[model samples]
Target chain A: MIGAAQLLPFSLLGALVGADVVSFPQAMLSRPIVAATLGGALAGNVAAGVLTGAVLEMVAMETLPVGASRYPEWGSASLVGGAIAGWHPVMRPGAINHGVFVGIATAWAGGWSMYALRRLNGVWAERALPAMEAGSRRAVMSLQLRGLTADLFRAAIVTAIALLVWTPINDYALAHWTVGRAAAHSILAAAAAAVAGGAIWRQSHGAAGSKWYLLAGAVLGVVLVIVA
Target chain B: MTASDRAPTTIAPALSWSARIAVFTRMFAVQGSWNYETMLGPGIGFCAEPALRELPGGPDGPAYRDALARETRYFNAHPYLAAVAIGALVRAELEGRPAGQIERFRTAMCGPLGSLGDRLVWAGWLPFCSLVALLAFGLHASPLVIVLLFLGLYNAGHVALRAWGVSTGWRSGLRVAASLGSPLLQRGPQYLARAVLFLAGLALPLAIARVIGRRGLEIPSHDWKIALPLAALFAIVLAALLVRLPARVEGWRAALVVLAVLILISIAR
Candidate 1:
């Protein structure tokens, strides 16, 4: 029965992590594994979120947020992981799937929120243009604060809502959702492998003569199986 | 239109260090959504199509200031776009150029910067970090460790790129990309880097698998899976459709196609 109030910490943490991606002292704490683990820890499910975040983080490793390039809204992706892991019932070992769904969905939500926030910042800055031209530092400062504050509030609200609504739903899912272990592992592992292969494909597909990168990744996959 | 105004007397306000940091933060605002062109709504990231407004002042009280207000309007419409536009604005003002001249320079920078930014930063760098994260998944490591590693690789790379972009001009940013060569050759180095890191990423997983061989971590046996191969078939079919389609289709459409294919496969099971 988590409520909107319960989501404040995740929202605040998400904003802080998102902020760190571009501003502040640049602490790496906002990362998926760390942030999600922290989220789980807050909700008394550190182990689940941490485990799921680790997997998702690995799959996400190929994404590099280079200049003006759009990345997966990891701010929310990690938050979802933490939330799911924290709130989902652990008596059943199938909690990871719930976290995955939540993480992926939240990542999408975070991305949209970021765009809205950017638009908001732009409008705020425009309103202060006269004062800005007149050497009014206070005006410019105020506008900047407005943008920052709005973003902080948005993250807090999203976190609160997701936790309050999603937690109980997740419980119902765990209690009812049924799939064989063979099927579950086959699907999850396959999906993860496909994503990994795609990453290798993307990297190798671009090289001039290096078809070997793909071969290497394949060999690595085989090695993983052999060793496992 | 006055000679004095063109004589470099209209000094733009100096941005403080804190302001610069805020501007830097603005980069993240556009990081995962759209490229500069889309965000700016078709022209140069923001400078190309500034929103105009009527000032309350008299006819000749610095009409350029009104234009400045328009520029400000452009910034206020989209902060991230504003940051890109302002970078050029600051450069133009520093050079004592008129609005027309500034617009020209911004126009010149936007196309290449947008294309390169899309490829280098979003397309190339972000995916590489995701691969690193994926390796952690393979290891079944704790989520905390994964997030920390992801934060380390991604934020470090992103912030460093932004710092580089802000400190140096767009030219330097391009030069950095060029240093890696065309997109085709650029990833060769990354693959090599990945191979090295793959070894590192695989270490713990290998050790644990050895200890738990044929136990705890075993996958239950099943019939040869039909789902993934079907997905691959669907992807190939769609990719062929995409390739055969006219190139005039929008870039977002292409992204959507790929996304659709991925989603179909991910959910097919």
Candidate 2:
């Protein structure tokens, strides 16, 4: 179990990665694969983090953050998921699945939080409207700085709240898990693959010359599988 | 508000490298204030402020204020490619171009840059790199290696786009459309999409194998022989469902509910 003291740094990382989503550099660090893995490291279980991250990534592929389209915020959500998964670092029944559940839920809520932030920004922009109209450099800088600060705080709050709510549930689920290990692993794997399948379909659906590439890649994949 | 501020745009003296770099760096934060009203308008203003400081009023002057006001006004563009708009707009302001022309340029640049970056980065390159990393995970790569590989590969293209974008926009000014015609912008997404589709095919199988095989985590007494056939069958079925699942189905939500139900049942037992 993570102690109360450890939660601060964990939540802080969550804030940084969360801000990276759309606030700061927009680097891929906010990505599920990276964020989860980082969270795993923080929790002393890199493998656990990667496992959760892999599952999250498959579902996240379906989400494209194109201009203004509402999509789940995966950065902090994945971190929460990764931390939960890495806490015990056991690949046992009910371990990873619960984490993924928590992550998906956080991401869904994070999307709404982002929408709210947009409105809050509207309010701030309204306040700065006069100075902006006067072409004040201070006004522009102030708005950007305030917006950036608010987003960071938003991610931190979302992350802290998710961790508080989900950690005990994850522990309980893992404690009470009764399914055979094989079945549990198989079920989670199947869910992940299914999500990947949907994502792959979306990627290949209407693109020109994608079928050939997919086929060629499949052959290469098969050869690699057989060779290994 | 004056004739010169609204005069027809002409290529003006080159922006000092210092000013150009300042604008470039600030462009990264352009989406910080993204909102419903102006979308990226305020951010655009933020980035343009440094350059506008060079106006006769030196940040407090009428010329600076006029250009800053117009530049910062409502605007939208892809975050990565926004440097392009910033670069061009800075050049136009320095040249004392018409307000309407700068406004039109700002409006015109958004759709193309947004779609172009979306196609190039989001739809194309992002998934391609992710699939590569996924394959590495399947193959049991170390955590650091997998992360470094993904970030290094993804950011190479990401940083390059920004580095090139601002400069390109500055040089081309109103002629920025020509840059879009380049093979990298035009055909780049198509190639990346094809590669991503292929990588997706390659990675998915291996990932399924890892999942069912319980590879890497290497649980003791894991029988591959029994798991392989069952895993293959489950993979096919679930993957089909994922692909064919209707939009109406809230797949993730439903999955959560089902898991919750199962957990409750276990608790009851």
Candidate 3:
């Protein structure tokens, strides 16, 4: 029931943006920051939700989700992640560790779901190829609607599962595992850093000249932290 | 084949003014679950073919080619709004003009609009989203803030690109690029390069995520300052992977390499 409640908003957002990915007005609703915030708002933790979303946004920044290139479905992933993060007891009063973990796991699942749905979209597109080639605007619109609606259903299911399962799984794991709080937190931090590093490195690879930009961004980031 | 060989039904009636504009806008507006191949090529085909049939020659070989050329030129100028002016143009041609004038007009429009789409839509508007998203992150704003900022920025870009791309695709075609201060030839490759980089930027994050999963490493901070540098590092590694691949692998395969390395690192760790 909790999952269903959270999932509804994400499903709607995904349908809206996923449809927008190809249909209606092109909008940025699928973006992680926006999606996560919406998820957080629905979950009643706007701040935590946005925090988790921002992290996912940073981690997933390089994704364009254009064409056949499979990308993490931030629209749904952010929603699930934001909900989980916002709900975590440890995340209030500016503690972001629990929220971050939830965000990471949810975002990973979201990426997988996105890939799965891409395959589904391909199958549906093939089925609709005749109508697609028929030169009927309405026919093309129907095909687009079909794939988009399917995506909505897929995201909804994923969100519902994630939200329903997160707390139980988190408790079981936490109860079973005993590590220093710092160590456990460090591991999460390290993972986030590694992901961030990997993401940055990947982009820098594309533009060798962008090293300076990367360096500049890092220095600026550090400066902001020191000042804050 | 000569015009005489054409069937009588092939020469359909002209599209109305409103219809022309609709055709133009529909070009870019078609998207969501469909991939770029589907939307840009086949999707356009769906609208263009009918719009062509509604025209005098029913988008005859020359007409179809002309439409494609016009769309392509418009795409180049206003890559973001390539679809906006197409419907309107097709509608206008279908509605009928003096014989021999359509081709001339289409040809004229192709060059400028192509350039305009590239500059105004592709370069100008796309970067706007990045700026807003980046600023929000820098400020440590809430997810809602980033999302809202992105929405505002993207919509602004969208509206501007639509208005400008359509106007140029309609009025000057190829000259639209010139009006936007983008020389067609020189800017074309640069634009292509930029697109490649932007795509690379987008792909970098996912690639990084995969790598970290493989490496079993995590970041220590929830801040963008740390995140940005990490992203930069990931990009470089990706570039190196691209360089190291035996053959020139395109797209996702390259991402796979990054994933492979990440897994190796994870195992090693």
Candidate 4:
């Protein structure tokens, strides 16, 4: 079991990255790949972070954060995934698979949290309206800062909760898993590939001459891989 | 008033270099106070505060208070493009334009700017960069290198867009919309998106194949030699079919179904 002290840094990192998603900086640091990598580093394992990040990135490709749409929140979820992948005693063949599973589940939970956070923001905004309507600059600035602080705490709590719940579940599953190494790799690869392919398909499906572009890209990719 | 009928307004060069910097920095928090009713209402007001403080009469004056009130109205846009609106509004407020006119201008620019930013940044640039980063990761590049590559590629465009949007919107006001909505600007990202999509489509299967090949699955005979190519072909076809499916099939549902099938196959084997 990971110590509470060890989880603090990850929780903080999650808070920063989560706030980055729609608040301060809007840098892609909140992205699953980056957040997961940072999470892995905090947990004292970079390789586990990278692997978990890569898989999560493929799954996240299908998401499009447009307008007020409610999509899965990958930031805190990736942190949970990376921490689990890094801390597990056995770096089993299905480790990445398990990490991806936990990451997806966390993301779904994070999505709900995001919706809740938005509602919370609405309440804050409502309370500040009298001062805001009076054209108080201090009121406006304080409200904005308060919202950011709330987002930070929201991400931290989500990451800590997810870690507390999923870490034990992941460790137990890895210990008792029956699938052989080869089969596990093959299954994960196929599923990841299919998900990625579907994401790509959705992206280019309506565009003109998309099929040709796919073929061209495939050929180029194959040639590059072969050469390398 | 008609464009020519209005007296020639002197552009207030009053916003000092430091004030502009402050506004730009504040632009980063344009979504900080996001809410359902007002969306980015308070955030927009927050960004304009620095400029309001810098007006000729200073912070607590009527002009500053009016400008602050003007900014706090319902406003939302792509966060990146909000910089454009911020710059334009700052310029307008500094020039002492009517509060109503500036608000109308902000409202008018939101929809077009939102759609344009959405297309360029979210749909085109981000996925393309992610694909490039994935390629680098697959090739065993260092994690730092991959991180740098992803951030550098995505932000180069992102930072450039924010700077250009602000500067251009400041100078041209509503006229800047013409350049923003130009087909060339739109098509450039679309073309890049297509190219990136092609590369991703090609690379994903190759990566999957490599992973499968590395696992060294045992077969009864040489019959398993065909398995790799068959799997690759099936993936490509499956991708094509999924893409061609009706919009009713959500991406998440498709992914879950595929995942379930793979799990079932693994368990049975």
Residue range with the least summed lDDT across 10 consecutive positions in model 4 chain B: B215-224
| DockQ of model 2, rounded to 2 decimals | 0.62
What are the per-residue Cα lDDT tens digits for candidate 4 across A34-59? Answer: 88877777777777777678777777
What shift in Å separates residue B107 of candidate 2 from its native position after superposition?
1.6
**For candidate 1, lDDT tens digit of each residue in A91-196?**
2434555665566566657667766666665565555555755534345345545655676666666666666667877777656655543333334333333343
For model 4, the stretches where C-alpha displacement exceeds 4 angstroms are A206-208, B1-12, B209-234, B245-248, B253-269
Error of 3 at A52 (Å): 1.2
The number of the candidate with the highest DockQ is 2
Q: How would you class the docking of model 4?
A: medium
Q: Summing lDDT over every window of 10 consecutive residues in candidate 1 chain B, give the lowest-scoring window.
A: B46-55
Q: Residues B81-186, candidate 1: write the lDDT tens digits.
A: 2334445444344334566755455555555555555455444555555555546655655555656677677777656655555554322321232432455434
Q: What is the lDDT of every predicted structure here?
A: 0.48, 0.79, 0.49, 0.74
lDDT of 2 by residue, B199-253 (tens): 8878876765665554554644456546655755675676567667776554455
Per-prediction TM-score: 0.64, 0.93, 0.62, 0.91
TM-score of chain B of 4: 0.83
Which residue runs of candidate 3 sit more than 4 Å off their true CA positions?
A1-7, A17-26, A89-138, A174-209, A213-217, B1-29, B33-39, B45-81, B84-144, B173-269
Ten-residue stretch with the least lDDT total in model 3 chain A: A180-189
- Chain A only: give the TM-score of model 4: 0.93
Better of 1 and 3 by lDDT: 3
